[model samples]
Target: MCSTVVTPTDRVQPDVALPFGGWSAIVRDMSEEQSTSEPTRAFREARDFLLAHREDYETAYRDFDWPRFDRFNWACDWFDALAVEQPGVAALTIVEEDGEVNSLTYAEMAERSRQVAGWLTGAGLQPGDRVLIVLGNTIPLWEVMLACIRAGAVMIPATTLLTDADLADRITRGGVRAVVTSSSEAPRYEGIADHCIRVGIGGPVDGWLDYEDSRGYDGPVPEVDTAAHDSLLLYFTSGTTSQPKLVEHTQVSYPVGHLSTMYWIGLQPGDVHLNVSSPGWAKHSWSNVFAPWNAGATVFLCNYTRFDAEKMLQVLATYGVTTFCAPPTVWRMLIQADLSAVEIQIRECISAGEPLNPEVIEQVRNAWDVTIRDGYGQTETTAQIGNPPGQPVKLGSMGRPLPGYSIALVDPTTDEVGDDGEICIELAPPPVPLMRGYRDAKELTEESMRGGFYHTGDVASRDEEGYITYVGRSDDVFKASDYRISPFELESVLIEHPAVAEAAVVPSPDPVRLAVPKAYVVLAAGREPSRELAGEILQFCRDHLAPYKRIRRIEFAELPKTISGKIRRVELRADEAAKVDGGERTEHSYDEADFKQA
Candidate 1:
């Protein structure tokens, strides 16, 4: 067993011997130091309350309260405390496609992160300094995050897939003072900034500090007087409609606020949780770091160059993943495979990133004997709505308001509370999970926080039972022949067809009806696009949808998506409008008018 000795002052004592065979940290008996910090006690009580009533949604929702913290550092007070209490427990496990598995226990991670924190301070990454971290789902990614938290440095996570131009934009706009990236990606910053600090992972690079050197630092971690409201993270939103907005989160916002997310995922201590999301996105931290770790669960990651359904199933069984969360895209793909072929132990399954179709959820439930719950949230906040464990899930609804959040559906035009309108979060007390504001954009922030609520820009309709079913984005919902239409409703139906792999519905400009619903589809494996196939698809829609909502045009093509894997329907809408203005038709588009009645 390994342990950390924390004093009443929250400082580590002299190094103690550990059986795990890594760097020695100030080891202590957690039972003796359980009440060392008030913040720790408060945080634990709130967490324990949720865990005690995970399935009892009524009690959890009614009695749960956000922990009040005037001064709190989650890494020091919570994660470190967990490390001392459950030092031998695996905190993170990363399995590679090549069959290599790397595991880090709680005690090891604490010490390693401290070493990294020391190295960072020594290297001039001081408190409040912004560091751009560009790496994949590797061990250092988690290490750096913890170290940054401990060091009180603001972090801006960047995807490895970012181009040179993207890096320049982030470095310029984010005010990045330092960059830690793989050596291979170092060359991309040649002309960006020569004076900025460069720390390379993987191996040594010219003029770049080697990250491997951090392991040698056994010095005490630098003291960080981080205020509870100090900015801790800056996330660049995926630009679906316009320029990416820089979202700012404080120390308490993401770290303490993720308690709601922990409850939504139904995470339990010692549970193995697997979430499929790339490193740069907010969802990555939502599950991979804060949510699971907040519940004292192991964060499991299966890394592959490309997604393989069968291989993923095997990994799930191999690691004994108790909780699994993936995007709607992954769930749809999983249904295409022989899901029953693998015997797994996934107890709680969840779908997020986008509203999951009922068809995908039904297939997974039939095969796995566990319902795939759907959740809703954005980069601006933690889970605001979800079908948590023990709740009777509605077919298309994203469930009820999560604990700590007060949801309101308001008419966008009149700003009146209604059953069907834009989803909004009440700001009466202002939930802890909500973002501080958009960085460097004062006007936009004010606009979002207007009318005593944070406008989510997405539309939804709440049933009498309080379950909210997502409609399209406020801008995505259009009118065809003076009738309101939702693209998601039609796209969900389109994807149910066996030949369709992915479908995006957008308003196709027409002089006759003013506008009509058009579907841009991607064919499934072994299926080819043709006139006959297009007609069949249109017929399928005609049979399922009402007369006004029928798809008037069908085109088989790849849908454009942002770097974060969200579909950019704005592009398709613009393309269709331009085509009508130029009096031209897309070469591959097939109109329903061409297909005559029998």
Candidate 2:
């Protein structure tokens, strides 16, 4: 809550005490028209090194160094520098479904964000004020995000798909002081507290400030003296297992930490990068905002009401997209279409959000001759592990650790480093990409950082070659018949079956075996749910999986998913347990015993 704004003539001495329990080297008072600042220079050097060695993974990983600076605002230091240097470069491009394309240059975006910052500041937006953003993939989302960075306000991004209860929970838990959402979404906040500073986009709403009003304000905004560790973004996780914890990021964590993500995606200057992700999630900020911009790549978006795989493919080909990133679900849907029909210019393709199945990867590679590299990380950190460009990608592996991240897979119970265990990032040296900590949850944060490492709840195994293959979440991986079972491994094989569109594997209660693997599956398009189809799918798993890890039950039904598109296996597990207690079974549920009796 420290407002360390200083004027051009006010030069404070080093190690100024901040009220927020941090020490700043200096209270920076920078002019917009000034030449390249020290922070800008240092950041550019790190970014340029990655771009220079984009294809050379070993050299980049070994020789690269994170940019170290005391005072840095990515919007002010890096993005604004790019605007001054390459004013006419396309920074963002949004292609609407109706053939409308809107593109903004670096200078234009910088100026707009500056105007927004000035307007928000004039309206009494103070430093450390948390603003909840519930907008979509429009131009204003980027503007407001950058403006908040410029104005020194913390951002809490929420998805428009959130329900009223979800909104209330976020508003209360996030301690949101302001909200910027679309005019249509403004009414959704009617039941929430009315004390928040609400701004509506696209149109006017009663009692809400109009976002369009910022266009008239072109005055100078106050300079923000943001320290490296100041809170910038507060993300609400998908909560696949439990309630979503507020993941806090500092000025350096995501804005600068995404240098690793930039490297993972293999983005370069002037490259058109298309990332299929909805707003409000971490990956959206990862690929759509920071990573592409960090590499000076054009952030491209194909805005469509509904996803059309052919149209998405055509858009990539038409726009000459050089690098593309999408979730595993999108990849699965894209491969279902005729990929060979559209010849895309995408040089790099990556998948995140969840582990990409090898079947989906193979299909895309076979059709487009471009391998889809899988990467690993959570909302708590940036891309910690990934298959960078020019690396030998191992099938079904998320690949090696990126630069600036020291990964250690440790046994959960023993906390011993090993080849197969829970994925943990070393805390010694504190990688710049890691989050500040979980906000308002000291115990949870302490637990995560307990054993000299930031423990990722997900588990994985490392090969002798150092490549990492994702296992299931630590809670999701259960034991059946005295054998450990990875739900991801089982689900991956389940999806390989042609009829299964999506699947979630969880343990079902059993009196004899303690528990057995049960798969809840969603059928592919034109596929119907039937006993014969379930038998065939189970047979597919039986053939592909080991006897111990075989899926014992199959239910042809929609799998529960978080709004971020992650399968909620915890819910599925609870449902199975409840059913066992009640002596109930779902209508579409089929068991291996039925086939055995037949």
lDDT for residue 469 in candidate 2, whole number 0-100: 96
Residue 511 in candidate 1, Cα distance off native in Å: 0.5
User: Model 1, residue 45: what's the lDDT?
Assistant: 87
| RMSD each, Å | 4.5, 8.1
Query: Could you say which candidate leads in lDDT?
Result: 1
Error of 1 at 554 (Å): 0.6
Write down the lDDT of every candidate, Cα atoms only: 0.86, 0.85
C-alpha lDDT (0 to 100) for residue 509 of candidate 2 = 89
**CA lDDT, candidate 1, residue 394:** 94
Over 67-184, each residue of candidate 1 has an lDDT whose tens digit, in order, gives 8888878888888888877776778888989988877877888877878889989888888889999999999999999999999999999788887888899999999998999988
